[model samples]
Target: MELKLYRAGWALALPAVRMLLARRGRGAGMRFLEERLGRDWQARAPGALWFHCASVGEVMTACPLVRRLHARGAAPLLVTTNTPTGARTATRVLPGAVGHAYLPVDTRRRVARFLDRFRPRALLVCETEIWPELYGACHRRGIPVVLFNARLTERTLRAPAWLARLYAQALAPVRGVLARSEGDAERFRALGAHRVQVVGNLKWAGCPADPAGPPPSAVPYWAAVSTHEDEELRLARIERMLPSDAPVLALVPRHPERGPAIAARLRAAGFGVAVRSRGEPPAERIWLVDTLGEALRFMAHAELVFMGGSLVPAGGHNLLEPARLGRAVVVGPHMEDFAQETEDLVEAGAVVQVDDEGEAGRTIARLLADAAARRALGQAAAAFVAARGETVLEAYLAELHAARLPLDRAPA
Candidate 1:
């Protein structure tokens, strides 16, 4: 069945290959594949496992696993990610591993070419990325494919029946699934995933920020992480509503490109300001850490954090990042993407959900007024994450092994 699927997918190669001549910025993903993988790409790696993470979050989750594999003598494991940001994070964090482009859009030929070249013993896929043709091609070549930290949302559950059926068929090629939570496992089963198991969120094991780093001044500040335009604007208003004696604000925009624009908006709003990444940390002004790779560090420095993506309908960003750092968390109403985790935190007094910026500001003011209450909330958040531990890793590694091909050689 998988072979036939791959055969049908082979037809997509014409368009995929043509991607090379298309506009560089547009269809660049496909173009990248065509340009990078030349003829005879089926050459196998000497001794390596392949881990595919779609973006920055998944890259962070896969870091510990990659290190564990290295400790177990799996050197030179190949890492692949679709986004430029993911690639940068992987390269920066996964030290000593070979990094490569992800197999291009599910065209059989592209997948085949990729497998032939990387010839990894096994393929570990993070989260919900399932490419039928890619998995089918791997199956055809006797390579194992596994889905790790898999998750299926309520929206995914309520998909049109036909679409769900199609998705089930698409997922049929993978050998096993390591779901991030019990809810995730149940959803996968409802959607026809086999060999599914519940693994706690890998975010629990996310690397901690260096405590030795210079301490941010002991000012009463709240962090707004991974925020978008709408959220940022709303937060600026919230900041304004705070009492003049309130601590400075740490606003980390999700995209670095928007830093200047955000800074301008904040300044125009009549708030004294400093941009952290621009060497402008005003001793008594708001600090906009317009940098990347340090959201968690800032969280550690914050008295409280309002997670981003919740303000608008973007399905909230990771609240666990702050929770794990022992910070009191506040979030906007929209969190369907991480419904279960967020709710759990709320129930445990680890998080507070506000309807809008007004509520967020009010909540922060309340917490700021009561230091003991804030500490208590932060403690609970930390405890919740610590309890989850490495359960996610165990389940994911188990599933990956189920589909693993024999290792060509151990790392020396």
Candidate 2:
């Protein structure tokens, strides 16, 4: 079987994998190992719980559960993130209470070592992180795994039949699944999960704490948040079309490392650009919010926001941040992931949908020009977020509580 082969492959490659991981540092593979073996790691309280969040979004979604776990005396909430950014965000959010680590490569030995050392009470898997060796190791140790805020898009369900079966095999050890939506629950059932509950999307409640201090600057601004490479250039084009009297434009690149290159491109196209961390706030044109974690701060001040990833192939970044902050919202045509939420907002006249760069530019320009329209949209956006958020978060907490009860006393 594919699953057996995968386990065997990891077992066979353990030595080389260990060697490779040992040298990889905190950027990726061995980061998890380093943190696991770090000073405080061994000092963790007994019977602590482990929660795996795949990346930034998953980590954001898991915060509520992590908070609840810690409140219930689940000391040493072991949190692992696959991305460096996610690790940074976790540390920022969880502070002194949670342990941050990189997730090891899903090799059998590494997973076994990780589980044996930590011996978590229960494993809460956020979103769709279905690691075969990891789950298998957990099963062997009688640890229950729960998938919280679970979802399966149409694209996932449309994968090859063998791949679907492989997915089911990977998740077989999971005790319960808390799906983000009814559609997600149906997909899990089709893929052969035993128990799936249709909890609403967890993102509805995922707002980071408000940033301390005033807006970064006094300049009236509008933000283009989580903008991708393709979307960034398109945004520059949009900026050119705006009236000079319009508010300052803040462009936050999704990847901070890409900031310089994007700034260069935007400058070449004749826009005045100020990279947030470096330059003084320009009296004239765009504010390039090229720093990490500051986009949310900038979003809190913007008059209108264009959420990115939707502009291109990436499904979309979380839009709730901008909406919850009561900013008028605009997004592109490709938000397959947040399509339901986006549609709901658009129908309520809270969010503006645009087909491409031209439309995006015009929509933003119009929103800026009409103060009344901006105010009405902002109110609508905030209301939409408030109405749906608590319902989703409470349901997810209930599911997490249910999943944790059975695994709390397993002989580890």
Candidate 3:
């Protein structure tokens, strides 16, 4: 009864979804609508491997796997993402993908049409994208639906009963679930995902090869990455507390549009600031990285890194990125979304956790003053990430082969 109501409600919401997409702008939004409505779009190839990454973060996590699949001759892979940024990253990073597009709204008919058109041999849903209609449609067609790098937070597990039941039902058709941690695997099982396996996180697979040419900036700096609203002001305060001779501070907000506002705020607060998008780095004390896909680049050159999102309630961005880069890392108290990984890193002494803005300032100052401590932290972080190895990706490939999925190395 509840499932029927959900289907009805989703069907009724399709028109509103179309209007929202149209309002977002024409480029990818219009293209997405046209494809969903069964006009002006075609799949690059039938029986392709399909991967869905919801946004930029997921795109990063999916890139390595996509590259491995392609190298093994899984040609004509189809990638779909809900955000334009994700789509762009997918296209840029996974050049082997036959196509990249916004995922269609999850109405029954639209999902069925997508399945019929693409005819993917298997569908890989990246990190917490549970679309009931799409899963059901693929299941009916006998296509394997695997959840890759899956994670479930405590809040999600303890959601209101009705929503929890809906999620459980939505996850029912997944053939396999590769969780990021054992705790996440348990949550998926509690939410009705059968065959859950603890495959660890693929983000630990390691950082991308260095970009060709010189580093983005040669000056030594401290990086504040993926910061959320008001976190910049807090970071500014922390900067003021650092030693007078400490390296420059690079402020990289999670959203590029916020760069101007952040720069203005820092300047208004009487700090010397330079925006990266405007061109060359300044000799100012603060350099605002007003761009995309360059956070890792900045982290690579930093004396230390303080990941954002944790200062506020944004569940924190990936702490592993900086750790993988072998940079001394600092985060705040609210890393609940990355609970398992955060705890493990903290236990290994690879990351420093502060309880508040004041503590963050003190911690940064202490690390900056003691170069030896920074080196120790960085070395520990790199080693901790390296210890995870490639077990996760290997497990995923083994499962895919065992299921008799089509692949270059699989028997014809």
Q: Name the candidate, 1 or 2, with the larger lDDT value.
A: 2
What is the C-alpha local distance difference test score of each model? 0.73, 0.77, 0.81
Candidate 2 clashing pairs, residues 3+ apart or interchain: none
Q: Per-residue lDDT of 292-343 in model 3, one digit per residue for the tens?
A: 7788788887889999999999989889888987899999998977877889
For each candidate, C-alpha RMSD in Å? 4.6, 3.6, 3.1
lDDT of 1 by residue, 15-62 (tens): 664554354325344434443343333223444678889877788887
- TM-scores for every candidate against the unseen true structure: 0.79, 0.85, 0.87
Model 2: CA > 4 A from native: 8-40, 72-76, 83-85, 99-102, 153-164, 207-212, 277-280, 401-412
* Candidate 3: worst-modelled 10 consecutive residues by lDDT: 206-215
Q: Model 1 RMSD to the real structure?
A: 4.6
The positional error of residue 135 in candidate 1, measured at the CA in angstroms, is 0.9
Model 2 per-residue lDDT at 398: 72
Clashing pairs in 3: none
lDDT of 2 by residue, 56-95 (tens): 7788888866775566666666888776667777877774
For candidate 2, the lDDT comes to: 0.77
Q: Report how far residue 240 has shifted in candidate 1, in Å.
A: 2.4
